[model samples]
Target: MSSVPLSFEQLGSYSPMDFLTPHYRQQLHASLQYLQRPAGTLLLHKGERSLAQYYLLSGKVAVDAGPARQTFEGGSPQAHMPLNGSQPNPATVKALTDVSLFAVEHQLLERLLGWSQEAAYQVSSLGGMVEEQADEDWLARLLGTPLFGRLAPSHLHALLARFDYVEVEAGQRVVSYGEPGEHFYVIKRGRASISLPSAYSEQPALTLGEGEFFGEEALISGAVRSASVTMLEAGELARLHREDFVELVRPTLIPQISRNELARLSQQGSRKYLLLDVRLALEYRLGHQPESLNLPVANLRTHADSLDRDTSYVVTPEGGIRSELAVHLLNQLGFDAYLLGEQPPLAA
Candidate 1:
């Protein structure tokens, strides 16, 4: 076992790590686990499943695959890739010398890889359509948003194709409080303020600049808009109709799980998942699942950095927009979250 300082530069040298965008690489670095094993230690037996993708940082490891045996050394070109492939590793692996390794959750690695590929494809698809430098800049910023980063390539392309461009004048209200949410809007060239009705005095209004988005809460929950969005200046916007948003984006962004399924998952997995109630603290105090954690949806952005990325969160379904909004925010922040379904089947 060893305590070695691993820099971002050394991390950048790994295969898929080299392929990831800087932003994605930084996100991966936050929760990456550093591991070390002494010489003669058994890393993995043949046919054992690996939950993480491990990369050799230093020392030597011997791999035995059937009749073939090979020794891999750290800093070698061969060591730049994951020591173990997907689950059920075919090779028996042992540390030949004291070894240092960095392990990324297998699912996390795959998700980041998928997003990286989709982002590159999106850039390519833009081609000659990016007319101005400013347009190019905003497009890049838009791509960096968590919503866009998480979308499947097909859904991304389709959503991009379906957006309707709109021009807004300063002080115009795009969507007002209590109105049904008709569209999800992405700011292309302007600023806007989001504020709830005067009755909700506790929460302050928020400003959003270009490349930011809004209105998803209403669309996802089938509820009226809780806040009004007013343009601060004349700006361009790209809006997706509610139907399009639901059809093209909802499936990927907001997955739902029945209560029974969640119970079954808890019983079957070694990993423990958590239930999150996203209603306000007062609302939570009135009634909430005893085991669930209460963190209001509005405060999720501010508090989410402290959350465990390895744990999956199930948002309670009772709060409608509040719960769904929390799921969206959590997913955007790179947390695994699912909405609890409204109905659960009778126990057998």
Candidate 2:
């Protein structure tokens, strides 16, 4: 077998695929695995599960199901789509002749397609305003983000509609430390600075630019803002009201489990769950769940990349807000995370 990069021309005739935006079509080139197989090679067996979508590229293939069989030629209408679209593939597929094919992860393709459709609708909904065209880069960035990518198209569209655009001048305070969280903000045109209070360790401040978001930490936790966010320069922001955020975004992104449910999970030997306590090191030293890992909420984003996405994480409840915030951040970063509801006594 061999591998080859997919070109736009090669995918132009495929259904649904043709609907994807040019940018996403290009992005698919890197994710698709191209392969070559000799005649009579069995590519897929009946009743087997497949996580990828396979497309015939350059030869004929035979699809057999029970006593019926069909021959599909490359470039033909039948071959333009995936060899098998159902789970536990109902048919067996084999090469009728030396063949070349490409496969893309099912979930990844679905996400790109959803993003493309949603973005197209968003731009067209604005009547193709010049400003919308100009902000296409930021829009694409927002859509490609893990959090946004996972949202259903309908929910994403609703969230987009609820956002109110606002302008800020340099040095304007967008969110102040100790203030109740009200709205979630996404930078649309310029930059903002994040400053922690002096009482906290002097960690350097953070700067956020277009396509990046803030206020989620406070929103998820339902706590006072831990840091102040100020405009570094004149810029535009897309703000979602607290109510809209809680209703549309929060429930979709963060999954939750009760302490009793967690105990039930622990009883099952088939799956192992990781417990993460997002409290301060001192707090953790004093008391934490047995065998739980600790990584404070303040430092979560910085070290989030090092986490193992394959491991399911249950954020341990301390103040409840911190655990919720940690789970929100984990989900936003594409980790399999669940917030543990109800705080249990920490082990001494």
Candidate 3:
């Protein structure tokens, strides 16, 4: 028998094992097997029954499914057949270098899934190898996104773990206005449309493709969706539940405003409050806070005189650096200001 002992910490880097209770890790460890593959090997093919899920202990592999392509390079692990569903499109898995892998068969996994928490831990620890590889794939893609740029590494990993991949067909309504929001979605492939109701025709606010995200506001605020989002074509998406939204997305969004600060600000009447909407005139005309004064961020400096020095200005921009910068500009101008909100809003 091989005498190599697995390292749990190393595996945690690429898997959701870190999020699992300690008991589950022990369960996984008992049923896991370590594997080593030489270079130039085919791990699995598309449409093949997944007998076992494999995790890279050390090495690399490339996965291609039709137009969607992802490569799991060395130093990070990769997982095969982690999800239960129809077989994935036949994907050619090629080792870029000599690879070390840990595997757990579906039968053993089935037994582990039904086991007690302690047993689950043992199984999970063993399963950690596969989980880590899957995690690495997700992490690689997530870290490459601009939306996740502001996040710290730890926070980013947590968010990645919470997301589940989903696929939708063209013309499917992913989200509907007035429906309770459940998950926030990020487009991984294909395109989607953001639309809102209108008398003549539904206004398409935007068309987004790879790396775009939506439903954040709904997730944060727990409010009815404000717009309808439909898949423009068959596509893949990464979805984060509301619970994950609070844990992952919310912390990275606009910095937290203190309750004391909010209370103090609320005591001041509306006349003392200046709501600045910094979106385009057309967007402002489409919809906005009725009381807000439209002074698009671009024109704010030129029209500085439009703002009142006695009032506390509240800057709002489409969720991004624009609004944050607006606040900075107001501060530099000796005006008291805070960021209020943005358009095409994200969840609170």
Provide the clash count, candidate 1.
Answer: 0
Comparing 1 with 3 on TM-score, the higher-scoring candidate is 1
Give the whole-model CA lDDT for all candidates, comma-separated: 0.77, 0.78, 0.59
The TM-score values for the models, in the order shown, are 0.73, 0.67, 0.38
Better of 1 and 2 by TM-score: 1
**lDDT (Cα, tens digit) per residue for candidate 1, span 142-234:** 766657655655667778888878889999999999989999998888899998788777766789998889998788878899889999999
- The residue-by-residue lDDT of candidate 2 on 143-203, one tens digit each, is 6665665567777778888888888899999999999999999888889999988976567
Model 1 poorest ten-residue lDDT run: 123-132
Clashing pairs in 2: none
Error of 1 at 28 (Å): 4.9
Q: List all candidate RMSDs to the true structure.
A: 5.1, 6.7, 21.9
Lowest lDDT block of 10, candidate 3: 120-129
**CA RMSD (A), model 1:** 5.1
Candidate 3: tens digits of C-alpha lDDT, residues 1-348: 222656665544535444433343554565466666678876666765554556665667777666887877544434532322234425656676787666654433443333322333322332222354543343334433433433554455456666678878999999998899888897767799988767426433689777667887665545688689999999778788888887776655443233344344455121256667777778778777656777777676667787787676776555345666566556545565666632443322
For model 2, what is the alpha-carbon lDDT of residue 55? Answer: 85
Residue 242 C-alpha lDDT in model 1: 92
